[model samples]
Target: MDTYRTGDEGRAAQETSFRAHIAIAKRYGKPLVIHDRDAHADVLRVLDDEGAPDTVVLHCFSGDADFAAECVRRGHLLSFAGTVTFANAVALRDAARVTPIKQMLVETDAPYLTPMPFRGRPNASYLIPLTVRHLAEATGADLDELCAAISATGDRVFGPW
Candidate 1:
């Protein structure tokens, strides 16, 4: 779930909806994939208030090392996207370093946040390797091991394919 700094009324409604979505995910026993843009504190606050789902994925996680550590502590998997491959994402790289391999995942955030060297181009799952390769380097993780761990995380989050 995501929300901007809309008016007070709008923010209230969005938070209500976010809470409902969390409830639904819990009821169905599915992972809640969050699209937190800049509302890290509000997202964490609401989740804490409503109780997060069993499996929560911080989709395209954009938080810094501190927030990443908090999420990891709460057992929420951090799924890095192409943004992590950007040259300016030093904090993101630090976040990845703190996140355990078992708690890390990867994504393309398709049609957006394309990895470097092709940043202006449209993104797709096919470009995931570029992001994955960058992530491996940034986190100082073996490429093969990172890939394997990400695959396992996929199964853990969404069940076997």
Candidate 2:
């Protein structure tokens, strides 16, 4: 249920589809993965209107600390991508700090948003460790502990591999 902001012309259609997907996710008892891009308030409103699923994941989370806290309070998992490793992502790092290890996940955002040293290059799954390392630093969690927590959270959210 990733509700994208497709501009004014397609807003209605996008929202309608988002609502339908949310409904389907709820009916099937599946986790909802949200990819919000500058439409944070509306996304939360729609989720509230439709009632969020038991398991909600904010994929490549782009919100600030307050928004992260709100999502955390709602029991949503915040998945951080390589963007969080950027030097300019102070707010994102702050959000990560507030998020509990159990509620946090790491991603590569592959083909884009590569971590600092590889910023100009295409991202890949292999670059995930760089993001994880940054997350560990940003959130002040031990590297091994964060990795273990991420693994457990993955199992809880999507079942074992």
Quantify all predictions' global Cα lDDT against the true fold: 0.90, 0.89
Q: Mark the 10 consecutive residues where model 1 has the least summed lDDT.
A: 1-10
Which prediction has the highest lDDT against the true structure?
A: 1
Model 2 per-residue lDDT tens digits across residues 1-161? 23343657777776788798899889999988887887778888999998998998999999999999999999999999999988899999999999999999988778888998999999999999999999998888999999999999999989997
Root-mean-square deviation of every model: 1.4, 1.6
Question: What clash pairs does model 1 have?
Answer: none
Across 1-161, the per-residue lDDT of candidate 1 in tens digits comes to: 45555656677778888899999999999899888878799999999999999999999999999999999999999999899988899999999999999999988888999998899899999999998899889889999999999999999788888
Provide the global lDDT of candidate 2 against the true structure.
0.89
Error of 2 at 14 (Å): 1.6
Instruction: For candidate 1, give the lDDT of residue 42.
Output: 94
Give per-model TM-scores: 0.94, 0.95
Alpha-carbon RMSD, candidate 1: 1.4
* Candidate 1 local distance difference test against the native: 0.90
Clashes of each: 0, 0
